[model samples]
Every structure is written in structure tokens, then in C-alpha cells.
Target: MIQNTVPGATRTQAQRTAATRAKLLDAAVDSLVEQGYSGISTQGIAKRAGVSRGAQLHHFPTKESLVVAAVEHLVDKRLMEILESQPDPEYGFEALFDAFTGPLFDAALELWVAARTDPALHAAMIQLERKVSDALRTGCLEIMGDRVSPDIIDLGIELARGFAVSALMRTPESDREFRERLLPVWKALVSK
Candidate 1:
């Protein structure tokens, strides 16, 4: 039933549903930013979106569902932004650097910390991994323009995500020190 509203094509119910789903998704992300997963509630999301609880329930009836939607939304927004920001086709690897150095890393780190005890959040992250992974892979290939392998791109994503988790941990060293030390890991990943 879902279709794209195009000039000549039929606008299917699915498109409408997807748009509504995205609305709730944007709201859920706002909620997560306001309150971590544990602090967000279905009713709160519904109210913030100006939709009834039942309407929210139509897409995500439970906290896990809402969390999943929000995670998906976050991943998509980030990937799109990264993809859209290509300086030029010639500077593709720079895109990868830009992605790892920015908000995407912080956002994922926050989720990783919160998901340690929350299975639903953890599982939702798996879905996010797929999206992020694909975006990284495609973005890398586009920038590398036949120089980089998808396998290496995948490895880069994995290593970057791991660094994001470890770098933000409580340690005797200061956060700045930890970030300064993060270079070796990045060096290991990109150096071939």
C-alpha cells in the first residue's frame, strides 16, 4: 500500500505511513536527547509529537520499538549528512575522516554506554550498525574511487566504533589525553 508521491506515479499508503513513522521517529530522537532511553516514555513521545498514544502505538507500541525507531532515525540522518558533505569526488577519504571526527562518534558512544544494561537498546544498535556500515562502505568507495576495499571500510567502521566506546571511559588519564592517544588506533586502521 505504500507508494511514492511522484508526478506520474500513485502516492501509496506506504509513503504516507513512512512519513508518519518518520515524524514519530524525529520525536523519539528528540526524546532520547532530552532523556536517555530509560527516561523516555511512549506517552511522552506521543504528547511531544501531538499525536495520540494510540497513534504512536500504531508504529511503536513499546519502549523498545520507540528506541529502535530513534536509533534508525539517528543513523539515517548522520549517514545522509556525511554523504551530502563530500567536498568533491576527489576528496572521498576526507569524508570518512569527517564522519569519524564528528557528532556521529559522540552519538554512538552515548548509545553504547546506555545500551550496556539495556538489551533492547543493544539490539537496536545492531540495526544501526547495518545502516552505518553501509553508508561508510558506500561513502568510502565513492571517495576512494576504486582504491579502497569494502572489507577495509568495514574494518574502519568497527575500529572507529570501538575507539569511540573506549575513549570516553573513566580512566586515570583525562579525556583530552585519551583522545590524544586515540591517534594510534586510527593510524593502525588507516595505515596499510
Candidate 2:
């Protein structure tokens, strides 16, 4: 008999399963960010994750399920990052805006666009998006504390998201200027 040793040898079956699922979900997010919605596939995700096709299917039986799960997983990870970060006394709003427009938004934008014409994907994304929005709202409240009204935070989120979307249509130079000009206005609004 041959002896077999692996790094996860001590992990329970459930732990191993969860690890594999996480790997697949992460790979799915990478695919979504890099390839857009139409470019993602079960086979590609499995290959990227270094897992078998059957394993991917075992975890998520459909493409919609896989993409939705990936979105939820990525949002949860980003929320944790936001919640655990130390707020900057001088540039908290700027930092928050940057975090909102980061890679998570890019990946989620791809899914949002795809969902417009995909009933199943749209159905799955609606709930996940709401969950993400709620989590982000709570995180923002915690970060800002009593410094700003809830309405200001809500407007700030919409403004940041709109800027992020508009950036996709133009060059980076204009986007930089736009943010530079808008930041003070946003700060003033929050200080009111």
C-alpha cells in the first residue's frame, strides 16, 4: 500500500468541502471581473479553480446559482473588509468612496448588466443586491457614527456609484477632476 500525505490531511470532510466551495466562488468572481458576464462558464470556472467540473456542479448546479453565490461571497468579504477597517479621522469619506468604487463594484456591475436580460440571473441578483446594499448601509452608519445624517450617507453612496458608472464611459483624466471637484461638495453636504 502507498502512503498518502496532504496539507489538508487533518481537515474534516466538511472543512474540505467548504474550502473547495470557496475556491470555486473566488474563481467565479475573477472570471466575472475579467471576462464580463457572457464570458463566464462552468467549465472555465472549474479550470480556474483547479477543481473538477463535477465538483463545481456539485457545489452550484447552475450558472445562475454559481454567479449569485460568487456575488454574495464577494460582497460578504468586502463588507467584512469595510467593517474591520479603522476609520480615518481626516479622510474617512474619501476612503469610503474609494472602497465603494473598488473591484467589488466592477465585478458586480458586470452581473448587473447581464441580469437585465436574464430572468434567472436577475431573480437571483435582486435578493443578493439588496442584502449587499443593506450590509453596506449598516457598515457606513457604523463608520460615520453621529457625524452625518442617514440621508447624506445615502446620497453619498448614490453619487459614488454614479461616478463609478460614468467613469466607464470616459477617460481617467476627467474622472479624476470630477472627483476632486465633487469631494468638497460632498464633504460640505455631510457637514451640514
Candidate 3:
């Protein structure tokens, strides 16, 4: 006689492991975005992921490791999005600005502040920053395609990041106006 089976019973052990890891990673990132690094707790992450605390511990034994993994997960996703978009030069600045100015940036800012005081987090952040910088450079190169010098592209990205940071201090409408006003000037400068 045939036996009743679960719908996902055919999934291999590796697939199940991967699925659990993905859920944890996603939940961790959401926690980072919502609670910042200082506020996140392993139990909270596990509850958000709908996984047991043991499962969370089994996957990420330390809070630092989980936070690092979550940031890396987000960076990888953003890099993939930038690579896939293949934006034209006219829209490239907007795309780069978008990448630097969202929930990812908010979480990153929180980590950056906390990393300043935590040695282990500082080290992890250094490596992660290098990875992000390289990926962003690659994406910029692909998007600009010789239209702008590498130095110019670097400067533009920094400027965009600066604007993003400044956004926290200003009203949203003022920030929008500031970007709109300066973006044209930046484009003109780069075009020369």
C-alpha cells in the first residue's frame, strides 16, 4: 500500500538546509533593518524566521556571525540587482544613488556606528566594506562603459553616499530638492 507523504518530502537534506539558512538570513536582514545591530537578538531573529532558537544557534552560533552573514546577504543581493539592471549612463547615477540610500544603507549606517566601538565587528566590517567597494566598482564600470573616468565614477559614488548620509539630517522634500539641484551639476562635470 502507498503511504501518505508531505508535499516537500522529496526535498534533499541539502535543499532543506539551504532553505533554512535562507530564511534565517532573510529574517536577520529584516531585523537589522528594523532594529539595527544593537537591538537585534537571536531569539527575536529566530521568532521572525519561524525557526527554533536551537536552529538559529545551530546555524549562527554567535551574534556577530549572524549579523555579519546578514549584511553579506544584503550586499550580495544588492550587487546582483546592480549587475542585472545594466542601466544606461543617464540613469546610472539614479541607480547608484538608490543602492546607497535605502534600508540597506540604514542598516549599514547602524553597523558602521557600532563597529567603531567593537573590535570584532570592526574587523568584519573592514572586510565587508572591501567586498562592497569592489562589487560597486565593477558595477559602475559595467554601467558607465568608458563614458566616465574611473576616478570620476568613484567621486560620483562618494558624492551620492554623502547625500544619502546627509539625508538623515534633512527633511525628505529638502533632500529631494538638493539632489535634483546638484545631480545636473554633477552630470555636467562628469561629461566634460
Candidate 4:
């Protein structure tokens, strides 16, 4: 019974459901980023999304489920960006770098720390991490194509992740300087 706003076009039940789910997932990620995992509540997320609490509950019965789904949604989005990007090693590297350093990573980081203490979240994250890892690996391979070695791709991804983790402690300017210095070396290694 969801209504479509598109001019003269109606959305199917599935499309409406998907739209509602997407809104909840997006709001969930925003809450995670703005208010650490411990601070977020389902009611807050529903309010953020402008959806009813009942709707949010229907989509995600538990907080863990919502958080995990939000991470998965974010991962899927980043993977799509990686896949659609221009086929160049440098461009691909930058894309992966952005993905690792972006809001998606921020939300996931919150979940990762929270999961350490919450058994249910830990189990959910373990599975989501596997899926996310596989997807990103596949994205790296796609970006590098057959020109670069798998080892090189792995190194690049790991380096990007390292940079992401490093950002948590380092100043933004400092992190940028480090990345600027290291990117060329990484490019040279992969280009070989």
C-alpha cells in the first residue's frame, strides 16, 4: 500500500517494500555514524527515516539485524561504485581508497568495536565481514583486470585498509600527506 511519487508511474509492492527498507538501512547507517552503535535505538532510526516504528520493526526486528543489514547495504553500494569505475589501476586504487575511508567504513568500524562485546552482533558481523571481504576482493580483481597480479591487488587493498585505520588516530592533513607519498610507490609496484 505504499505510494510512488514518480509522475504518472506507480511502484509495485516489491518496489515500495524495497524503498522502505532502503530508507531504514540508510537511516541506520547515519545513526551509527552520528551516534555510535551503543547510542542508536530503533525508534531513533525510524524517526530519522521518517518511517513509523511499526514499519521499521517489520523491516528489521532487532537492532543487530538492522545494523548488519546497514553494513551490508553500504558494502553493496561501495562495491557497485568500484565496479562502475573507470578501468585504470590508479583510478581503481583511489576508488578503493575512498571506499575504505568513507562513511561505510565509519559505520562498520562502530559495529566492529561494538561486536567485540556483543555476542549476537559478533556472530552477525563475522558473516557480514566474510561477504564484504569477498565482494571487495572481487572488486579489486575487476578493477585490476588481468594486468595486475593478485598479490599486488591484495597489497593495494590492505594498504588502503591500513590507511583507513590509521586515519582514526592521525590528523586529516597528515593522513593525506602519507597517502600522497605512498600512492606513487603503490602505483609503481602494481604497474610492474
Best by lDDT: 4
Clashes of each: 3, 0, 0, 0
Return the TM-score for each candidate structure: 0.68, 0.89, 0.90, 0.88
How do the residues 63-164 of candidate 3 rate in per-residue lDDT, one tens digit apiece? 778878877888889989888867776787777788787777887888888899999989888988888777777788888788877888788778888888
Question: How does model 4 fare in lDDT?
Answer: 0.86
Sorted by TM-score (best first), the order is: 3, 2, 4, 1
- Per-residue CA lDDT of model 4 for 1-192, tens digit only, reads 656778879888888789899999999999999999999999999999999999999999999999999999989887886687555755777776887876899998999899999999999999999887788778877876777777777777778888898888989989899888988788877677
- The ten-residue window of minimal lDDT in model 3 covers 1-10
Model 2 Cα lDDT, one tens digit per residue, 22-128: 99999998898899989889999999999999999999999989988988887788778767776664465775577557668888898889999999999999899
Deviating ranges (above 4 Å) for candidate 2: 1-8
lDDT of each: 0.68, 0.82, 0.83, 0.86
Better of 2 and 4 by TM-score: 2
Order by lDDT, highest first: 4, 3, 2, 1
Name model 3 segments beyond 4 Å from true.
1-6
lDDT of 1 by residue, 4-111 (tens): 656888666777677778778777777776676667788888888777788789888777767666766676776677667655754554465456554445545557
Ten contiguous residues minimizing lDDT sum, candidate 1: 101-110
Q: Candidate 2, which ten residues in sequence have the lowest lDDT sum? A: 1-10
The regions of model 1 sitting more than 4 angstroms off are: 1-16, 88-94, 100-107, 166-192
Cα displacement (Å) at residue 4, model 3: 17
Error of 1 at 121 (Å): 3.6
